[model samples]
Target: MGHPNDDTDKHLRGSLTKQNKKLSRLKCSVHNYDWGIVGNNSQVARLFALNSGSDIDPYKPYAELWIGTHESGPSFVDHGNGRLESLSLKTWISDNPNLVLGERLLRSGAVLSAEKALSIQAHPDKDLAMVLHNSQSSVYRDDNHKPEMALALTEFEALLGFISVKELMDVLCSVPEIVELIGSGNAKQFLLVNEQYRDKNAKAVLQSIFSQLVLSSRNKIGAMISNIKSRLLPEMQKRKLTDKEQLVLRLESQCPADAGVIAAFLLSYVKLNHGEALYLGGNEPHAYICGEYIECMANSDNVVRAGLTSKHRDIQTLLSMLKYTQGFPEILRGVSLNPYTTRYLPPLDEFEIDLSILPQATSVVFPSVPGPSLFLFIKGKGAITAGISENDNVEEGEVLFVPAHTEIRITAESTELHLYRAGVNSRFFTIP
Candidate 1:
């Protein structure tokens, strides 16, 4: 709860009288995490340096560049009053909801720049999110579901969803130590079952096997992990390794003697080349491995971590919430609406993304839209002119907040400009 005379209300009072406030350059927040790429090797660190106009340290693990109104790490909106006054994007949106978020996006969204592997986790759906938040406020934190899309800014790797039943069975057969943990009876039962991969009931069977593997007694898990290290590390040192094997080796290093190493083999491993994208909704079990990507999601952070984390793990809650369908996760190549723009439309109405590119000296106009939007400059330098006033120079790593029904024009000043526009879309909206 906020006070009545908050800065948000004061800023809105003067701005609402104006016909168009257009675009405002935003100062986003940065999160540093242990798993992030160390030092200037991180894209996030570079961006933070650029945004802060400070020298790079080359020693910090800059992790997440969060641009949004989310309470955890909200971006700040500059009032442009030549004073030191500023307001959180969340507060600004709250005060001028109709003017900023628009009718379609009464709910807003955010963009995240991830530099490393996030915890192996899933988010609860709307109903479950509310229940969890009310009952476990300290952990659940928020009542909104997080349905997200991650578009590769660089080569990205991730483990998404469950691997096919046949695939997991094969992995188990290859790693006898892991199979031994599940006991000979259960392993034999699972392997002998002849179930079609596409059958709906197949997921249930897969979950049972996976649950057994992940929830084995601590000593059993330790023995299996030790056995895997003994057998696999030598093999890796001697010769070539398969993609899945390589992933397993990597996870083992991060979380030694943890079941997540075994669990990684039961998940589909994916690599997204630059500019490619993938959409993940609530209850889809996934883990980012390493890479730089633009992640957009509904404004919530209720993560149910399963493993491969130092944070709290709610195994039962996480397992119960998963949409256990198994297969390779689909890679979404955004639909090209034009030569200049590609639209990444995820199923959720909370957000849609567009990657817009501009050739040197060329200009493009982003037409006024029904919802608020955030524009992030990923490559090249450009000048942005909003409506009839407020021009700003934007370079790589900077973000601009675009208000509802306000058009903006971008002109490239460098070889080429690449930027991403993310926001709630009217066409994608559906009453829930």
Candidate 2:
């Protein structure tokens, strides 16, 4: 398959000059992790195949499509001279920070497509991140805190934070295996505290119980898992299982007897329809369980994992770093910037995403923002014009990087265009 942007490159080579080139097409990188959806079944694989003009392997898992300057999976851009992969996006930003990043800092953006559940994990806060990075540089690669948001492109399922104390009590009363694994005495103490305090002491109580659950011996966890499966199998045959029950079975199938299978009951299980979003700040324990979503975070790759992975696990670090907040994660429906654009803004200074749904033959002009923006076109065909640059032809799965202070105009051709624009949060900096 030929590169989709080959003709666009030829047009750019003749028209663009260094002084007027504020927007250029980007070639992003894709990661193939075990949890990813396989081949073209994955949005990541589809987009990557289109952007890179590569043939898909049906057997391969396509996990993440990264569009940023993060060292783990950096993006490249065409410099208008027909060299599509000549310069790294990080190097371009470094060479022109004032023009590219403006007053804002770097951020990481990606599309995550999961087939199976991701690891039960938490990202560290800034202080902990710095300590972890200094102490274990190989694992905690960066010193920046990771505050992230996931905007669902498809039906998404995840476990985020601890469930409310009342909810936890209900699970404990029902799931005897979990109580047994955590020990009958500890479970009784947790139930007593929740019953009396009514969640006022949720953090302390949850921390104690969760610490015990996570610290349980592998043998005990495995035995409890077997007992739960035996109990649930009859229910599965007789009646439809609850979502949490179904999730437990599914996680067990993926990683049989893994501690995450037992630990999952403690966290809030959430299912998001398309366009709904979830925010996970630093020290929040969460796991992405099936589906594809657009994700943006602070530029870091530090994850403290305890279970559901073949990767390195740091149980002590994960237990220490978690916030132990108890509740369901709020699902963001997005605020409308216009009829064509909806913004998913998490409560963080790192990044925010604007989703644009442009109708066919319609044009929308976005005024200059204070920071650089990465535009990912997930659907439809369009032409984008930014600053003094000529219109850049865009199609599904293409990406563009627009520098700071550049007004962008996007015109949808024959179909409605769906794209996500990721940028630094405007609240973080003042335009001077």
Candidate 3:
């Protein structure tokens, strides 16, 4: 009514707004705060082309995948406004489930590809961890501990569950010098009961015997260990201990008598290569990540960690949650579908990932009708060109969310594509 050209201008403005909303705009950078891990305290995960460091550099455990939540390392995605802001992935998924998990959103299986073995420890059972964290004033983030599944992308090793009272006795008795630590009583019971002697009794015996044995070619404790062990481990020597066993010996040398390593061995031994994963939850005590994979889980920022680096050592808390029984963690693998699509399954419900590896130039359809989804380009390069011609490329670690009701199409240009898709699905039901 105001002017004849007003309707055309308004239509043009609406077109521009739709174009902007559907345009592909995403970026990534190596997590700098996640440097408290790796070889030293100063190691920073080198970032790619994107924003620069945005936090304190002093924090030691400095390696992180900046995707899901955690404001410190959230994936800075651009919203409708040209201005870029951090998006909370957890909330994003919860708001839109159809395009993410479809009908299987709740039946989620987050996958992990470790570049190196992580730590040998476990998160508490949900309630226990909650109570522990709730009771403590210093702990940060949510009290609901993470129950993760570690699937090895390569030859992976982990200490899953506890060693039995009997198995522990056998491993300790394997060395003659350690025999006295047991001394008539149940070695396990005595160490737990006798406070004054606990440190000096068993833990010390292990340290003196195992750590010293591998200290060097010539050492006091090492000499004693060598002398005592040759007899006790005659059969072990005859069979030649495994490489993992050798690695264990080396770790023992570094932290002799550490209950951590002893606890590590009590769990099961696992090894995997490409296309393999270890499904571990919070209760499973394993530490080591030696592969590269699409890692996804509930938006968690709490890690009840142990022996792997010289960082926070919650010895009592870690030990208190451990189950001293023999067990193993389940492993998940990927199924190749035409080299453009791969399905993965982990033993968890917090997250799931589907790798769509497209060759040359082609289009693929993902019928995501769940909630919201977090997608990334971890290999090759490609883009999801929504119906309006908006295109966002898939490059190493570049992520975006496929909101519910968005049936998108993606195509590669001038190269093969490797797309990493992951997100959280919260509809979980416990077996009664």
Strongest candidate by lDDT: 2
Between candidates 1 and 2, the one scoring higher on lDDT is 2
**Model 1 CA deviation exceeding 4 Å by range:** 1-20, 81-84, 102-116, 193-201, 428-432
State which candidate has the highest TM-score: 2
Instruction: Write one digit per residue (lDDT tens) for candidate 1, span 1-432.
Output: 234365665655467336336666667777778777767877777776676566666776777777776566667765454221356666666666666644333223333344545778898999999999999999988898988888988889988999876787786678787567656776776667666532545576668766876677667777778887788778977888888887777877777767777788788899999889888888988998888888877767789987788789889998888888788889998898777888998876778888988999988888887677888887899889888886678899777778877888999999999998887765653555
lDDT of each: 0.76, 0.83, 0.49
lDDT of 2: 0.83
Q: Write candidate 2's Cα lDDT for 1-432 as tens digits.
A: 133375754444334435434677778889999999998799999999888878888999999998877777778876544357545666666656565554243447889999999999999999999999999998888787888899999999999999987888888798998777557887777677635675676677677667777787778778888899999999888999888988999999999868888888889999999999999988999999999999888877889998888889999998888878888889999999988899988887777889999999898888897778888999999988887678878899888887788899999995799988888887777634
Candidate 1 pairs with clashing backbones: none
Each prediction's TM-score versus the true structure: 0.90, 0.92, 0.65
RMSD of each: 3.3, 4.0, 9.7
The count of residue-pair clashes in candidate 1 stands at 0
TM-score winner between 1 and 2, please give it.
2
Q: Write the per-residue lDDT of candidate 3 for residues 12-89, one digit (tens) a residue.
A: 344434543243333333443231243232212322322233443443343444554444544434555444434333
lDDT ranking, high to low: 2, 1, 3
Stretches off by above 4 angstroms in model 3 are: 1-62, 79-117, 151-155, 163-180, 184-240, 252-257, 306-309, 335-339, 387-392, 426-432
